[model samples]
Target: NRADGFASDSVTVLDPAAGTLTFLSEAAKLAVEEFVSRYGEGGKENFIKEHILKNFYAFELMMAPYTVGHLKMSFLLEELGYRLQDDDRFKLYLTNTLEMEELAQTELPGMASLSEESHLAGKVKKEQPVLVILGNPPYSGVSANRGKWIDDLLKKGYTRSDGYKDDGYYQIDRKPLGERNPKWLQDDYVKFVRFAQWKIDQAGEGVLGFITNHGYLDNPTFRGMRQSLLNSFNEIYILDLHGNSLKKEKCPDGSKDENVFDIQQGVAIALFIKKKGEKKDCKVYHSEIWGLREEKKYDWLLKNDIKTTDWRKLSPKSEFYLLVHRDESFLRSYEKYLKITEAFPLNSVGIVTSRDSFVIDSDKEALKRRIRMFRDEKMPDELVKQTFNLKDKSNWKLKVVREKVRKDEHWEDSITKILYRPFDIQWVFYHDNLIERPRKEVMRHMMEENLGLVSVRQVAEGIFNHAFVTDNIIESRVTLSNKGIAFLFPLYLYSDTDKKETGNPNKKRSLGSTMMLFEPKAEYTIKKPNLSPQLVERLTCQYKKTPSPEEIFYYIYAVLYSNIYRTKYAEFLKIDFPKIPFTKDYKLFSKVAEYGKRLVDLHLLKSVELDSPVAKFQGDGDERVEKLRYDGGEKCVYVNRSRYFEGITKEVWEYQIGGYQVCSKWLKDRKGRRLFLDDIKHYCKIVTSLQKTMEIQKVIDNIYPEAEKETIEFENK
Candidate 1:
């Protein structure tokens, strides 16, 4: 060791034989050698001196003006050391700038080297049977170029024998984003696992362990990453640190809290074993996040049991229900229910371009129209003029006049223009209003399927304030206004009534007992776009399949009316089901339903019909289509309206079998884009069967295989 110093303008390097030498004696060397042998190696370069000297000068030259006092010396020295130890590309340039000040100055490795010396070594020796690899990795993700570097590295590391490539390290930048930049598809901690695994493969004798963002445990974005980990690692330990740790206010008396990590954030720490064939789940011990004093990141883990089960069997929705709708009012009203169950609805307030054109509401045209209309009407005329400065006086003046008189007219045109029709909120029913006439037909209308007629046997006694609108051919609920009455007959009946209307039947209207409401299907009259008739015949060129300009409107008149009637009637299917995945709706399983050979089953519900005389009268063209003759179609159908009584709190498995239908390869050979119905049904059955087995096992354990001898008398006795 040489301890020679140099002045600012000079450079020097002292050979090992120089003055002020410091070396361990022969006896001490033997002791250190024994320790080194145990760890496998020594005699490696103590420091990459040349690399350090280069970066030191470069950092000084660049930061001379900004640095002060010891900051100048420390900054240059650290940069030089980092460049030398990390083997980064900037080392050579840094060395050129440092000019090799003195033997001692150039020998110091960068700040990173002092703390992470062992990790910086590029060499690997497989001396141990297995080593536990572990670390906390940086959690930052940012890049200027679509993460091409990451893609390149991952592609290079792929292999077939270990299923490394198939773990699904694929690019996801093509996915869509909202107004802000898309979150990085992968987090930094997961990246550490990948890098660690790569290094282990090179060494050939290490089991990787790491604590990363808890996101891998739950976020859908990491589905591929999680699958890769599961395939490679045998045992998995997940510590979910999710909760607000800090007080709502920063300090007790308006002062800042000193704890830097106290910011309310969630974290996940995972421990993965590299050796395959171990248990799938591991015993996880969670301490406070970062093991901060008095800060248990997983205090909840202590109070609540940490359950372990087959990773695949775990359900994301099991603990919480999601109601996914854009309607704020619906969400607010349902938020209370979320405490007990998970139920979220899709946004119900939707926009449509026309009755037959499109269904997507966030189209550019729609957004532009909305913003413009909001500006024109919401802001004052003087303010608008000052801001936009009218390009066309006539147009501006017309808008101003409309704003004063008929405000809606100012932007009605823009608001109505769109490529797709919007969702109609009227299609859903709330509990505020309910009336009943026919239920089955209404179901058919809403569901776009035909349901056969079924008699409405009142569960209670009631009389007809007006006639029940039922026919062997067509059925539907007639509006109170259309029935020329103020309310429903509200009839109830016993099972003994004559099949004919003329039996000694109960006539008094009863407000009790379940009464079935059935109505015919609502008819939609698509304005039949005149495309190349050839294109029209192909499903691909039709609605939702083609980019052709046409309208698609699901009229709300029927849905609104039905919802109102259903609100009034206490007779509705009571079963609560989850929202239908891959679609914007939920389902209600009818308690009254029984399988029928032809009609399947009937779920008693109060729903409205598009074919109602009143609905038809208001829309002439639609009415004609509703009444258009069908070849032997049933008059009435069962309606199964989804319930909002409970929140969704269960995870339901949804499997898709067929590809997409809009572009089925069988029909047009558009691979990767189309799906067939066969695929859908097949997948549905498989997923349903799997879920059914789990459910059956639960029932068998709870209800079956247990004897109840409370009433076991023999018939002979």
Candidate 2:
């Protein structure tokens, strides 16, 4: 009948027209029946049924080949349809399996989930027809697994993976294992690029295109990832976004550009095309601007066409704030400006810490380099102190650090590992007024706990609590934290202008007859009033045998600023400045002035008195200070203060004694190191007040005049 199958199921077939007997012929059937009687004892009907079912079962067992073949055929058809019969056209595979989360659980624990082959099976072909494949892969960073899981996942095929077996592999570990080095894995994007390249090779065609995270371009964590990509793609296009730049519908409010401290991390997108084998040299075009609508032509941008200005160069805007160090023995406000704007430029000012020994903020690359150099530059003495020494870097310090990292510890074990190495050619800002701070630091309350002046607290919270207590917070006051104090120490130290007498090696130490030497304790009070009282007391005890009246004054000030005394002063001794009088009644005036000088000696006060008018009181570091008495006569007072400690008015002291002037003079003079404690405290107070005042003005208009008034008075001019 048909050339396709048996002619009939029930009858013995005979092709009489061709004169040949078929296997189903009557004679052949008789022989088959006899053979069955002799060997196949089972009935023919049962045997036939069993044989047919067995064959069907075998067919089902080999169904994988058919399914796989169908996929291959579909790919071929698609490639042919797309006219990809050539040998060098690019091919793409876009997989959509369980997404990044599921993959982290199944195959790549402790790592970001990535695109898989299931989704891409239909997208890719055995043959290539396109130049490149590229698109934004769906983001899978929002999984519930904390970074702990990612860390473990990174070690899945490495030694560390065994430590975290409970987490297990992702759900889509469908691929066969190969002799690949698991330690080489850096991140999801890296895996994506590598996998895509492998698929391109499978296609026996052109190159690959991948659009993924741009972090590899610069981030330290992605260094290895970057090297891998660099080896693959000759051309790279980077589109950097301000921190937290992703625009997602699920976001409550789209994030804006901000300091790294304000947000977790910065985000960017990248386009990569491999140029491993090519006839023409690869061309690269980079541009940040997208979706441009022009007069006639679509302004599609290439990197070469993009101007340098189009790329963002980060700088602190006028809105940025700077912490200054001025009068503290080692601090000043302008010095702070210099520190941020010049010394430690915004780009270079990585971070500061309250506890210097415990926490260090270093450049990531610098840290790595330092670690390498430190290892290489070791002398025998250095090696003796270490518990263990590495023979080579193959034993990744990451493992060592991880092992040394105490469970839930606050600080890292390696002390030298955390140091920050600044970039060569420290960042210098050519533009003046690069940043304008809207806020200024000021004193919160003066005359609190009978102390004439007190420092302010910052408006924002700090990492570590300030070591000292502060007075009440009014509308405007200076705010300094432990963090600020540590940051401004160098700047403040550079700005001390008061001259100091040093002992000659062969001569006995003696106080110079240079009128009055502001006690080191007083300078300290003026500089860092935030230091703890215990520390101040110890310094005072060491500096002077019987603390001078000024030292006594500073001691009292220190006691008041101590955490134990702040609440007491706030409740019992807090005084409104309005109550203090500036009268010349000798009994009151002498007592007040004596107490004031005592506080200065004790490092409790940051006060400097000036003549009411300028030229009349001018002298060689000396002046006769007069006060109005009840008798209507001028009561003469001796003024033997540092000539640099000038007062603008009876109530307003010049607290912002320029730091650069002081440092330059000190450097040029090259006299023995003289430390002033009061300058440090004064610097802190002035800068804090300046910052607070500026901040208040930013929030409320017309508040600066009043704020400035309080700040000036608190400066104790």
Candidate 3:
């Protein structure tokens, strides 16, 4: 069974037990002792004793039988001529690969004073020279491997500690990553990679290969990890298999692309090689494989080796050492513009109500009734959950919600309007205690009549189209697709003011005020514009005029809607918040601001231009939406088998905002519900608004080139 002229002792078969009967059975079938006992020359037992048993060494550590029956079955196979017997060379111990260093230091009870297998594994891990480490480790975001040894190793090399404090981790270059959430770095696959890297570093030189999630390739959060790998290895090879369905990825030729595995997240095979000397400057080579899973992915992997496949040399830069290609020229220009976050100093993510089913509803009365039931002490939690079809999550438990609600005396006052989706307004029970994440810091500004810009920080769908204006409280995903959360940047901030007695009792408070004192005294909340004073001053100096906050807000909105701006800097917009390039020309700024104001009014559905409808509701039925379909030839949208909206154009019907087909989504969300006269008129106005928006966008695009020609550059201070 041995190689020609090679001793059996030269090769050792070592594997961790899979804790399955199938693994044991397969191991017995493949053993050389079984072969010698079955068909060797002379007596079978004597031949195995003389040759097979004396030379062959196979150890299965971490042996764990699922049941007593499985344990008995293993012994039965050994008794029935399987020749599976434990000698000095064959020992089993319960060991975890990630914690070999800790396990090697501890002693475990066994037939002798200590487990020989444990001792050997410890010795191999601490003292042996491992030249190669390769495997497809498990991928779990909520990894179960939280041992102190592995966590310490990760802190030392790959990621920041739990408190997010930098403790001399080699992964960080000079500055902290400044990430609020880096939980993805704790994935089981990442831990395994870190472990392998540590082992190779201990040995001073080795090769590490693994197939893992491709998120780290360009994800802004993994800059440190990418830098750490670059610092440790001499050469790195990456074969990205782009097939992320969540991002709705497509091949270069617009063909359908699928993942090699049945997972929404894409994967890549990464190879890291370290030389046996001082670490050299790292050279990274990258390649991509796309198309069908079997033909393109599997066939290519089966056919090509590292030397055979083509690779493109990449030069990763500082700050964010992204693995993917970037347009350096475009990025250099884009970086000069003022970021939205810098322009607006105060902003926050929108409200996240974990129990959306129970807390939010289109009908205000229905929401009121649900709240009444929730506040009722007599109503059992289970019954209340059943009534609202509420499913308790780990964060939003019924018991906790009931206790919070029971203590609040003014829970009814928390009911308010929310922009649930694009052009879809709904009432939400907005209580900090009841809702999972109310985002009170920013949302309090929108409690009354206030304006806020809704946009996502990152674009995973390869587009920068999710931007809108809201005048009310917004849900976390109000206008987002692809699991992206929307952030709200309110134009003004509100704070409580002391109640002062006014002479007039019947005088109405200002439109934006939320609280009022009763009995002849009125209280008005103070409102302050949430704009950076320094930015305003810089723009004022550049334009020779002090621009109002509303003017700046509208100008930003117009810039975001420009087709040229979106297309030219699409890659830059994908990584972070959109930046606004201020035009030094006052005329261009005024024109763009005028258009932005019109768009804002149109989106809010308060524009005088919307008095005229482009589409008309025809046909007579129950007015209930059963299904929605559009006919291009007829230029009509059918709500059911009978009723349809006429005079609708194909462009208007297929219009999208925030990754949602507007005309269809509005109707689809109202399925099986009767549409009133106001609802019918509203749909027509929405169609008109979309048509106007498309026309306005083209107008902005025409003047965008002139606007970009003379831009204001702000000082770093």
- lDDT score of residue 252 within candidate 2: 21
- Stretches of candidate 1 off by over 4 Å are 1-135, 140-145, 152-157, 160-165, 169-184, 207-209, 244-260, 276-411, 416-717
Model 2 lDDT, full chain set = 0.27
Q: What ordering of candidates by TM-score runs from best to worst?
A: 3, 1, 2
Off by over 4 Å in 3: 1-94, 99-129, 155-173, 391-400, 496-525, 714-717
Model 1: per-residue lDDT, tens digit, 168-238?
33322222222111244444445556655554443333455444444445333343454444545544555
Residue 244's C-alpha lDDT in candidate 3? 93
lDDT of 2 by residue, 1-717 (tens): 222112112211111011111111223234335536655645544433332111110000122432443344335434323222343221112222112332222343542223342223233322222233333332234422234434443324222111212211211122222212222234444444444443333332334433344434432233333433333344545554323323211122432333122333334445555443432333334334322124111233222433442443221111111111112231222122111112111111112222221122223344334334333424342362253333323433433433343231322112222111100111111111111111112211111122222222111121211112122111111123211111111111111322223321111112232133234345442232332233334334543332343333333333322232223223111111111111212233233334334333222213232112221222253222232111112211113332222222221121111111211222222123232343323333333332332232233222212211211011210
What is the alpha-carbon lDDT of model 3 when measured against the actual structure?
A: 0.73
Better of 1 and 2 by TM-score: 1
Model 3 — TM-score against the truth? 0.82
Report each candidate's C-alpha RMSD, comma-separated, in the order given: 23.9, 28.3, 7.4
TM-scores, all candidates, are 0.31, 0.25, 0.82
User: Where does the lowest 10-residue lDDT sum fall in candidate 2?
Assistant: 422-431
Off by over 4 Å in 2: 1-131, 142-190, 201-207, 239-243, 246-269, 275-284, 290-717
